[model samples]
Target: MTIRCAVIGLGMGRGHAKAYSEHKDCQLVAVADIDAARRERAAKEWNCATYTTAEELLEKAKADVVSIATPNALHRPLTLAALASGAHVLCEKPIAMTAAEGREMVAAAKTAGRRLMINLSYRFSPQSQVLKNLVDGGALGKVYAGRTVWLRRRGIPGLGGWFTDKKLSGGGPLIDLGVHRLDLALWLMGHPKSTWVMAGAWNHLGSRIGASQGKSYSVEDLAMAMIRFEDGSMLEVEAGWAANIKEGELMETRLLGTEGGLVQKNVGEGYDFQAEVFQERNGTQLDLSPHGPFPECKSAYHHFVEAIRDGKPHTATGEDGVAVQELLDAIYLSAAEGRPVAMGATTTKTGAGTG
Candidate 1:
């Protein structure tokens, strides 16, 4: 079956259009962006119809699948509208500004009998899949604690635009970058219920940039949080848009388990990553980086299409997005109130899908 696909919000959605256009079973029918020049450029590049608004694309494009990558604020409404239009949706991460909004979108997708997959890109990585297989297969023993970090030096995106506006982007790197590693860590740890969060955020860099450049910057440049899960495990997460770190960009996730451990990190301050498993054997510490016996995993976009086509359980569903969002919301709240925030049972449901 040829799946008709449309992409909304050309910033990151441009990649979505490319992915869909490259897929054999999918046809890129249209793309939408409020920016006229960007929309035109995207249309020319993807060779698809262009729209000034997602509503127009949804009404006229008739896509079977839609990728929503606009901004943090547009996720919920755009996802709901796409589902209502009988299109499976691949929404960008953080799901929405709040977990409540994510839950609403999930329910709407359920009611409409459409699939909603959150674009948690890290989980789709080959390294992540290898780590996940080991963790899930008990090679990592009982996972207990983990640490995830994504730091970049002077990498604030769209400095004076929606990304810097808390009202539009929800939070800074915590939501933008940290959420990817957070979701990957949680997925590897078997999706534990986040019980509480203690966090702190600083806007020193953003404030300085705003003052110097006379720009509007209202979000944090760096944010850190420690989350406690119901299973007695904990995850330490940190994300920074602008920091004094030595590396240009550093993304790492380390999970400590009872019998073994795993670490996945970027290679040489770049997007290329490698993961290794740690174990103690014969009074020696053994580090193993599995290269074979496991094939390369498919892309998240391809997985979403396969899930819709085969009726399989999709990874990074709306439920998983909500779980991550709840964690983020708690982290932001805790940072703002200068106290630990306890997550509600309703907000911290286990498993994906209907949770």
Candidate 2:
């Protein structure tokens, strides 16, 4: 079956459109964005119909699958609307501002009998893919703990825009950058049930930078958290948008297990990443970083398209997104109250203390 795909929010949605257009099982049917320039650009570049709003696209565009790439706040409504329009949805990270909203989206997809996937792009990376295989293949036996970090130096996105606004973006790097690492860690750890979270958020840099730029900023610049899982495993997560970091950008994920340990980190503060597995044999520490080229990993977009075409389950589902969001909400809450928050804890729509 040829999956007709439409993408909303032209900024990162354009990446979705490109992937869909390139997939053999999918066709780019339409694109939507609030900005006229983005709409025009997408229409010209993808040679597809364009709409000023996602509502219009959902109403008129004949799409089998819709990619929701709008702001953090729009994910739930757009996803629900797309599902109601008989279209599967591939939404961006942090599925919604809160777990309650995330649940609604997941329920909507179930009722619509359509698939709902999240754009967890890192899962598709070659290094991450290899690490996940190792974990699944029992190389990393009894995984008990992990650490995930994504830190940036002076990398706050759009100070005055929705990104810096608490109402729109939910939170700062924790919800934006940290979500990716957190989800990656959880997935590699076999999606363990989270138990609780203790976290702290700081605005040491964002507030000052925003004031200097005459921009509105009411979110944290950095966040760190410790999460406990049901199986007695724990995860430490750290994310920062602007901070006094040595590297321009740093991303790392390390997993400790009974049999071995695995690590995936950026190379020399660059975008390129390398993965290594550690094992002890004959009382000797062995480092295994594959020497040859990695197998071509499938793109998350292509995976969504194939799932829709074949009526199969996608790797990153709405449930996975919800789990990630719940963790994020708990982290923010713990930061707000200076106390650990339990899993399945309820929070208001705007998410834990936006400030």
Candidate 3:
């Protein structure tokens, strides 16, 4: 049974299209984008039908699987439409602009009886998978604390465009880049429920650059947060699109547990990553690194298709996306209100200050 796939928004959707086209059990049936040039290019490259809008593609493409890679604000509506159209959806991360929207999307998918997966792409890396296995195997027993960061010296993307616009892209790197590391940390730590968050955000450099370019930028360039979880585990998160850091790009997730500590960090300020495990045995410290013969790392699209076809669990689910969205909301609210935000039956600001 071949799964017919369609992709919306050709920017990151191009990767989706490529993955689906390459997968053995999937066929790239259609693609949609606002840009005529992108649609034409995708059509020529992937040999698929093209549409001007997501609505048109959903109406006529007959796709069994759909990938939503549109702007942040469009995720909820597009995902709802796709689920209603009886297609399993693979949506890009942060789920939606807000946690409420993410919940709604998850509910819609359940009602439609379709799979809704998020493209938390970073988890698909081999290094991450290995570390996840080790953590699950008790290499890191009872993880108590972690620090995850993705900092770019000067890497604000599409500075004046939708990426920098809060309405269109949600917040800045916290949602864009930070979500990846945060999710990785949480996944490795067994996804503890967040209890409260204290965060600070700034847009100093982005706003100045946008003003000088006569463009509107309304999102933070740097965001830092400390989160407490129900399991007594704590996480420190730092995401920056532009900073005075030494590296052009720096990404790392370190977890400290009762038995050992593990770190997955980028190599040479690039996408390539290396992971290490540190433990003390026989009164001697040992540093360990995963070698080859690692499990096959599958792309998010491939995992989504496999989940749909084989009833296997997806690497990232809508619920996971919602969890991340809740943290993001709490972080933003905490930053804006100058206090810690508590998550419970309902979210509320706490009297405790960042002090």
Candidate 4:
């Protein structure tokens, strides 16, 4: 039973369309993008119908599911629209501007009786899966700390385009890039309750460089935070577009536990990643790195299809997205308020604090 799917926002939506087309149980029936050239190109490549707007595409495609690779700000409205239009949705990460928005989208999904999956693509990586297995198997006993980094020497995108604009991206690299590692760490740590956060965000890197492209680079180009969990676990997160780093670090997540440790690092400062596991063997230091799989987000694409077909729970649920968003909100608040931000307790009304 092919799950007919539509891909919207053709920048990365093209990849989503191709993944759907390749899946035997899924069919890529249509593509949509506001950019006419991009829309036509994707339609021709995928050999499917195309629309210039998601509303129009949703009206005509009648797909069972839709993959929304739109900008971060558009996530909630588009997901709600798709669910309301009788289609399940797979929206990209950093689900919405606020946890409140994320929760609203989740509620809408429930009201519409539809599935909502956030594309935290890193969680579905084969290396991530294997490391998870080892951790679940107790090879990494009593996980205590994890760290994730997505630094680039000087790789800010869309110049003045939407990437830097807070109106569109909500924040900056923290939401855009760090969110992936945040999800990966929490997922690996069995979703520990985020207790509090101490963080800082800096825009010194991008603005100091020069005038950027179409959008205002008013947000931070770098953000660093420390997250405390209920179980006494901790995660250190660092991400940025432009930073004073010697190495052009792409992405890496490391887990340190009582029994063992696991780390996946970019081998050549790229998507080609290498992972290592450290275990004790009668006092001998053991560092192991098997031939890790290449970069592929298809697993997530396929998961959405099977989830819709089987009516089963999707891997990255709206609740998970909300949790991450809640943490992100806390981080930004911490940076702005110049104090620790409490996650579980802090809210708009309460005089609660995270520090």
Candidate 5:
């Protein structure tokens, strides 16, 4: 049983197309992009049919699996259309612009009786998988707190385009880069229910640079937040696209537990990562690191395909995406209101000072 796959939005969708083309149980049937050049290039490179719009691809491709790699605002509509077309979906992350929209997408997938997975790509790293295994196996015994951060010296993407526009891309690094790290930390800690958040955001550098270059930029360049969970656990989150930091790029997630602590951080300002675990053994300090002979961590695309084919559970479900979206919404609201915002309930009474 071969799964026919189609990809929309050729920028990151190209990676989706390549993964499908290489998977043994999948076929890259079609691709779509508004840009004619991108469509033509994808057709030539993948030798697959191309469409001018997602609507046309869904109508004609007859694909069993669809990948939605469009802008943040378009995620809901495109995902609804794909699910309506009877194809399981693998949507790019942040899921949607709002938690409400993410919930709607999840409901639509349920009504359609099709799989809806979000492309949280960071979870597929070998280091991440190993740490996840350790956490699940109780190696980190009752994790209580964590700090997740992703910062770049000067790495604002598409400065004047949809990425910098709040309406199109949701927000800046908090939604783009922070979501990945936040999800990783939460997943490692067994996904505690968040209770409230206090955050602050700034748009100093991005706005100034955009004004000087005669470009429109309306999102914050940096955002920081402290979140509380129902189980008395807490998390500190920080994300920035432009900062005065010396490192060109920095990424790290550290979890503190009753028995031990674990950290996964990028190596040498690059994508390469290293993980370490610290604990006390017989009243002596001991630090452990994962060496060679790690398990195979498949790409998100391949994992989605295998889950659909084998009737197995896949990571990063639509519900997981919504959980992250809820946190994103709360953080932004807290930043805008300059106070702590409570979750789960409708009323937003002040809790702690945003200091």
Candidate 6:
């Protein structure tokens, strides 16, 4: 059975539609957008029925699955609607503005007995997967620490659009870009129990670019967080749209483990990536980089379709998304409280002990 899918919210929704169309097990049946022009363009480009609202499409086409690419604030409502209408969902990252909202969405999915996949696109990147394999297979040894960063020089999307608006986008780079790296870090840590978070966020960059058309820049353009785990593991995550760096644009994540290390780095301005795992065996250091056909999106997109067919679980499942959201909430709470926000019990605690 072809999984009939609908793409809602034409911005990122178009990309979802394209991926779904190209998937062998899925069929793009309709497209919907609040903007009629975008909806019309999508309909013309993809040669599918288009509607001004998702409600109209679901009512008419009766979609089996939906990709909710609406803005941050609309994710919950749109996602709930899709699930309520007996459609599985592929929602964009952040899932919802807060952990409570994310939980509600999860409950909705359980109640409807449908699948909901949150698109943390970075987790699906080929380079990231290679690193994950090495790490998970004990090639990276005992991971002690890792650093994941996403920094851009002058890249700010939507200009005066919702991207910069705090109310709409939730919380700048932290909620937008930071969530990706944070998810990657948590995943690399083997989903270790997040003990607490200490975070610092700033609006310096966005505010400095003031008087521009960028929606008054109310959110933090930069966010740096330190996450601790119960397993004695730690991670440092940083994300920013603007910073005082001359490296043009830097997007990478490195894991330093006791047995070895794994690093995924971007090549200059290209989205093309490279990954490596380094280890010392018998006093000789070795570096391993896998090779083969690695079309990043093709793998992830098709994986979702195959999971639906084979009744298997996806790496980026709804459960994984909730874990990411909880970590994000802790990070933000830590920043707001100027202290570490605790989530779970730790294996070890730093305290005064009589030796």
Whole-model lDDT per candidate = 0.89, 0.88, 0.90, 0.83, 0.90, 0.79
The reply for model 1, stretches above 4 Å from the true place, is 348-355
What is residue 65's positional error in candidate 1, in angstroms?
A: 0.7
lDDT of 5 by residue, 1-355 (tens): 9999999998888899999999999999999999999999998998999999999999999999999998889999999999999999999998999989988898899899988899989989887899999998888788888999999999999889999999999999999999999988988887887898999999999898889889898999999999999899899999999988999999999999988899999999999999999988899988999886888999999999998888888778888888888999999999999999998663222111110
Tens-place lDDT per residue, model 6, 162-251, is 988878888787788888887787777687777778898877768878556535788777889888877888899998888888766787
TM-score of 6: 0.92
How far residue 201's Cα lies from its native spot in candidate 1, in Å, is 1.0
Which candidate do you rate higher for TM-score, 3 or 4? Answer: 3
Per-candidate TM-score against the hidden true structure:
0.96, 0.95, 0.96, 0.93, 0.96, 0.92
Clashing pairs in 6: none
> Which residue window of length 10 is worst by lDDT in model 5?
346-355
Off by over 4 Å in 5: 345-355
lDDT of 3 at 292: 85
lDDT of 1 by residue, 189-269 (tens): 988877889999999998798779888998989999999988899999999999998999999999999989999999999
**Which residue segments of model 6 deviate by more than 4 Å?**
212-214, 293-298, 344-355
Colliding residue pairs in candidate 5: none
Instruction: Please state the error at residue 286 of candidate 5 in Å.
Output: 1.3
